[model samples]
Target: MGFLAGLALLLLGLHLIGEGLSSVKGKRYLLARAFSRPGSLLLSGLLLGLLSGSGTGLSLLALGLLEGGIFSLGQAALLSLAATAGAGAWVGVVALAQREVAEVLLALGLPLFLFRGSRSGGLVLLGLGLLFLGFLEMGQGAKAFAPLLSLLNPGPWALYLVGIVLAFFLGTANGVAALALALMPFLGQGGSMALTLPLIHIRRGGQRGS
Candidate 1:
């Protein structure tokens, strides 16, 4: 139930983010201008990935921008690379404090969402908060499977395959990473599995971008 709830929240958060971005005034023009320069595009992608904490989400966002004629293919590719890096960085920084950050975002976003002038910004913030909270809930729910995972001593190749499968189902590197971390202590080969999961998800994100 917790995992399912988390998945629902995660999807909802992504939806809200898309809605907020699409509704913002001059958003396309601002994005196009930012993507005009390689450095600025990379920075924008990194910041977006850090905020969204999902390379897959960034890849989809890039695709949407491409379809909207706001970005060239090359720019979109660059954005995906930078965004993946930023998402990895986010995992390292926020893995432990996700709940706190989510609470803070919720506190700030709710009031802003009620005001017409700041609706877009509010939606983005609320989406981010929900994303973080979803990750936390998923991690908690994953604890139930610890005993089952502990029974197997999987090799690196097996772990890689597992990571790929999990990434495919989760559709978000952040969620997979959270699950991996939750189950790490139970696995005898935790180190290799830990490294493989994020790499698999990153590859998946790259593929989606392409």
Candidate 2:
């Protein structure tokens, strides 16, 4: 139930983001004007991910920017890389947050998800909340399987390989990273870091928009 609800909110946020970008089709050029330098573009991508709190949403915006003839394939790749890093930043922060603090944040944001009167901004908040909530539930579920996880004592290489696959199917590197962080005590630094690589490596790429 949490997974479905989280996915729904994620998709909704993506939709709202797409529509918001389309509505401001005129302003993308403004973005283009700001990102003339490679370093600047990379920085912008990181900032975008951090500000939006959604790498997927930033990817969609990057696609729009590409369509506007603002970003080349190489530039888009850099942007995507930066976006992933940005996402990592969020995951790190969340990993460091107290459990109670996270719950408070989720509770505070629930209304935005329930309330339909909000615009794109609210949708983004709601989506983030749902994503966090989903991750929370997943973490709880994983706790239930702790015994099974403990039985496996794979080498670092094997763990990384499996983590990549698990993260891929899970479809959110942040969630994977958060889980890995939670397991750091049991898995050690090497094993926990292994889980984070999948998030860094699984970024998506597509053709420059038509």
Candidate 3:
């Protein structure tokens, strides 16, 4: 985690922290408390979908917020599901678009606009920026290391599980997904993407419990 990756993680942390803090602050800031509403839930879900298009981090954040008493566990879980599903939807779109930066920016922009002017917005923006930059960095890094990605492309029935376990432990599904995508181009041309379903499902179930 260099400057960009660290920044993205930090921003994401701020968003969740702000949500929890805002809820804890109570009646003193009715405006801030508004984020706890149903609309906010939907927006948060969509934003989660857009950012990395992986619900793992969003779900974990929801769990943390719930634990902190920002939102009910049920609400947190529901939003997590929504966010994950939404991200899956966006992933399909991303695949079709074949333009990661454009797709990511579109996804993240909504939350920033919706959450703007609030205490959490500033940090969320920072995190979102970091995440976006990190995403670009990862993609560039992947392209630079094409031979390495090629070596990992061919599977031996273990890469799928390896990807999931690595993702879970690393706490960064983006990294896992990058590896998956890299391997995908070589997995019998159209087969690499097929593994994504099982891998994502595996990570999803484990992360929720975590």
Candidate 4:
């Protein structure tokens, strides 16, 4: 029950993450000017990933920028790199600060989502709130499943395969990483961590179709 609930919440959160950002596409255009310099483009991508917490979302944004001539293909590539870095950093931040972030988002998001117009970025706030909540729930599910799952040793390769599958399970790289950690606690601590990076990298490439 909890596992399914967590999965559903995660998927929904990711959907909102994509929609919320796309909703603010006009604002995202500002990032193109910020990307004028190589170093600044990377920094902009980093900040975008930090804010949106998803490389997939950042990639779509970059595509829009590229098509609109706001950025070159080379600059888009740089943006993708920085976006992944920022989103990777965000995973740790979310793990440690879930409670604080969740609380703030909820307090700010509920009313905004319900009353404020969609143009107000309410959906974005609500999506972030749900994203944090889903993480907390997923953590609980992991802890709950760990003990029962510990007995199963699927081996490193098999565990890694599972990690790859999970990484591709969600729209955002961060969500994929989170799901990888949540589902593979049976692989033991360091075992799962070892697989996460490669799995995320693979999924990012798949998402990029390159």
Candidate 5:
């Protein structure tokens, strides 16, 4: 139930962010110019992933940018790759600072949302807050299965299969990574690596197809 609730919050947050950002004037042109260079594009992708904490979220955003004429297909592909790497890089940070970030975003967003002119910005911040809160909830929910998971001596293939299914449902390698981090107390180092590796491959493949 907690996991499901977290998923709902995650989806809602992403949707709000998309809707809010889409309404921002001149953003498309600014983004297009910002991503003109490969270096800048990679950095931007990484920064986005770090902020959003979801490769799938980044992919969705890239797709939106592509449709908006702010990004070419090739650039979108590159951004997805860079963003996924960035999301992986953010797993530890998310584990440590999820609640704090969520609280900060909520504190800022709520007041800003009251103002008409800053509504879009407020929505974006609220979305970010929800995203982190969802992550925190999901982590807590996964703890319920820790004892059962610890009893299982699953092999690499089993772990990989589990990861694929999780990525499919969560729609992001980052989510899988975050979950794996949460389960590390049960899964241990080797199990976590086995679970995440295939999910990364799967996410990259999905990104390419998108």
Candidate 6:
């Protein structure tokens, strides 16, 4: 029941986002102008990479903002790949440090499988459905570890480190952000500093619009 409700919310949110983006099609010219600048695409990529690495949804939102047909489909595709990769790497490292392979795959693969093929967006709906189910199973498993939580309670730094790993493997900037928020109260100063990553890029290049 709870999982169904959550899945419904996820679908609703995606619908609203798609609708909103479509409504703004008139602004394509302005975006074209901005995106056409020489360093603009790379800056956009950097902004996306940093935001993605930090676990914020800003990078994905950056992709949406650029989706005004200002940039070619190829450019947007590359940006999505880069942003997701950077974000995934950050989360993957953290996840491996905290948990086993099976847990990690359940956290990721289930969604990928569910959302594999769709004409418009059966993918989004199904993926969210799988994620909701996955998390519920996770929570059930978590109950067994309740006793361990008490042991780790005083050592909040330990949890924050674990939380960082949790965020990274999830492949969700939003998930990462939520985890960071939940764990922030428990974290010490030095713990927060560990979140930053060095510049994320090899060579971001594309044509500029005039």
lDDT of each: 0.72, 0.60, 0.53, 0.70, 0.76, 0.40
TM per candidate comes to 0.70, 0.60, 0.53, 0.77, 0.71, 0.34
For residue 93, give model 2's deviation from the true position in Å. Answer: 1.9
- Superposed by TM-score, candidate 3 places the C-alpha of residue 161 at a distance from the truth, in angstroms, of 3.7
Candidate 1: the clashing residue pairs are none
The reply for model 5, stretches above 4 Å from the true place, is: 1-15, 18-27, 33-43, 54-85, 151-153, 204-210
Q: How many backbone clashes does candidate 1 have?
A: 0
> Which ten residues in a row are the worst by lDDT in model 3?
23-32
**Tens digits of per-residue lDDT for model 2, 1-210:** 443454444344434434433434457777777877899988977866664455675666677777767878777677777875776587655544444654564565566547655444444544455445554554445554456568977678887887888766765565566667656666779888886665555554322331
Backbone collision tally, model 6 = 4
Per-residue lDDT of 1-210 in model 6, one digit per residue for the tens?
Answer: 443343343233333323333333346566556657546755655544432243124334445655644567656655555555555454333332222433453354445445534212333333333333333433334444445444655344454455456445543334433333223333334433233211121112111110
True-vs-predicted CA distance for residue 165, candidate 5, Å: 1.3
Q: Summarize candidate 3's per-residue lDDT along 36-60 as a digit string, tens digits.
A: 6777877767765664455766676
Worst 10 residues of 1 by lDDT: 187-196
Residues 83-200 of candidate 1 have per-residue lDDT tens digits of 8788777666545646888999889989989999999889988987887787677667766766655666566678777777767775666656655665565554555465456566
Clashes of 2: 0
Q: For candidate 5, lDDT tens digit of each residue in 1-210?
A: 786677667666666665566563347677778789999999988876675566776677677888887889999888888887776676666677568889999899888888999988888889878877877787678777776776777988899899988888766566678777766777789888999988657756775676
Q: Which stretches of candidate 4 lie over 4 Å from their true place?
A: 26-43, 72-78, 115-120, 183-186, 194-210
Off by over 4 Å in 3: 1-40, 48-78, 89-119, 149-153, 182-191, 194-198, 207-210
Off by over 4 Å in 6: 1-120, 176-210
Ranking by lDDT: 5, 1, 4, 2, 3, 6
Instruction: Answer with 1 or 2, whichever has the higher lDDT.
Output: 1
Which scores better on lDDT, 4 or 6?
4
TM-score of 4: 0.77
- Candidate numbers, best TM-score first, in rank order: 4, 5, 1, 2, 3, 6
State each model's C-alpha RMSD to the native: 4.0, 5.6, 6.8, 3.3, 3.9, 12.8
